[model samples]
Target: MSPLRLVIRLTAVAAVAVLVAACGGAQDPDVARVATGLLDAVDSGDGAGACALLAPPVRTELEDTSGSPCAEAVLEEDVGAPSDTTEVEVFDTMARAVVGSETLFLSRFDGRWLVVAAACDPVAGKPYDCAVGMP
Candidate 1:
């Protein structure tokens, strides 16, 4: 396969593995708090705050995808502000949160868990398809 396609396939596999690991596992409290903070920022329309909490790559991807800065695109993202911060699942520095049916993925940096992806849905027998973030 092409190099780019190979990378995409690998990324998809990793995403699926992470989500699968989250099933029936213990959720971390600190991770859950950070995830909630992100959702709260989005719900409150604090675009800058939400953008600040995104992982560097996620922010970069948002800017690239929107052709605008994260501060601007974060608000304009079609994925609605997340709610129901429950059933959080953490695997080392990476985490997944259930926010009103959408899974929000996070990673830790500088001792803080920043959102790596949001508004993700796993297609049965396929990789996750995310709306507002990247793998």
Candidate 2:
């Protein structure tokens, strides 16, 4: 191929790569950070802090089910304390994070990531079963 043609082709390839990378082609640091932060808060027994990390609906659900405020109800759940994040998958505003043996779901709201579900376990041929959030 001519030198100019080769240059144009290379530039096009580079542009495509940039686009793919920007479109969640790899694990996002922000997503992982939020997931780990939530686990850390839970592990530390920081009920109020943990509740703050939760999405609004999840917090409300916990309060309604337990008939207690979110800060107190969140502590009653059996969400595990995973030391390290194993993986994070992000799709647009939604994300799934695997931390040790637990799987948590998150959503981007108000320019921040919030935990939508936690303490989730997979069920064969069905959706995940979570201690928090919709089941």
Best by TM-score: 2
| Candidate 1 C-alpha lDDT tens digits along 1-135 | 999999999999999998877653455676667677777887788889988888888998999988998888888764445666467777777788776666778888888888888767788999677777763
Lowest lDDT 10-residue stretch of candidate 2: 21-30
Candidate 2: global Cα-lDDT? 0.85
- The predictions' CA RMSDs to the true structure, in order, are 12.1, 3.5
Predict model 1's lDDT versus the native. Answer: 0.77
Question: Per-model C-alpha lDDT, please?
Answer: 0.77, 0.85
TM-score of each: 0.72, 0.81
Highest-lDDT candidate: 2
Cα deviation in Å at residue 105, candidate 1? 0.7
| Model 1: number of backbone collisions | 0
- C-alpha RMSD of candidate 2: 3.5
Candidate 1 residue 9 C-alpha distance from true site, Å: 44
